[model samples]
Target: GAGVSQSPRYKVAKRGQDVALRCDPISGHVSLFWYQQALGQGPEFLTYFQNEAQLDKSGLPSDRFFAERPEGSVSTLKIQRTQQEDSAVYLCASSPRTGRKGYGYTFGSGTRLTVV
Candidate 1:
């Protein structure tokens, strides 16, 4: 595959709504990461996964955020009771491995979520 792919390039949700974003990583990628980028801010790491196992989720803002990769390929980010502050671009990135070696990440175009 070319790189990480995210669906529904843009989404609009009313306050207190629930939204689910999807990500499709490059084929055979072993590592995946999710990040949130607010208006002019940089992307903040939300979670990481190696294969089907979630390795880290320390950056999730609240319990309303959840992510999963069941088959080690496709992943989903779900936000419940979305709020206005939750509006941002959700990015998905994938890499062959996580290490100090010459590894690089491929990021998706990101899903822009708007909460009204």
Candidate 2:
């Protein structure tokens, strides 16, 4: 019955470095999603997985961004060659199932990454 959670609610990174953020989805949830939110902008889907299978990743902004959900319940997003433009809040969410109306997603507070 745990809710979605993300680590290091805030992160500071130097340009060209790599950072990894973690997410733990609610138990028994079948779908997980990652999103990026820039300042004053809405969250944009970055990737998604259903029961360990990544179903969509076209939203990932660049090849430097990668994600994985090896166990279906927990996921991680890793960014290489961090750039200032990569600074944004990385949010994680989960739903009981994908494509089921009314089964809305629950989101974590998010990891705010700041590149300097």
TM-score for each predicted model, relative to the true structure: 0.96, 0.95
lDDT of 2 at 29: 93
lDDT by residue (1-116, candidate 2, tens digit) is 47888998999999999999999999999999999999999999999999999999999999999999998888999999999999999999999874647688999999999999
Model 2 off-target regions past 4 Å?
none
Worst 10-residue lDDT window for candidate 2 reads 95-104
Candidate 2: the clashing residue pairs are: none
For the record, the alpha-carbon RMSD of candidate 2 to the native fold, in angstroms, is: 1.2
TM-score for candidate 2, residues paired by index: 0.95
**Any runs in candidate 1 off by more than 4 Å, and if so which?**
98-100
Candidate-wise lDDT, in order: 0.95, 0.94
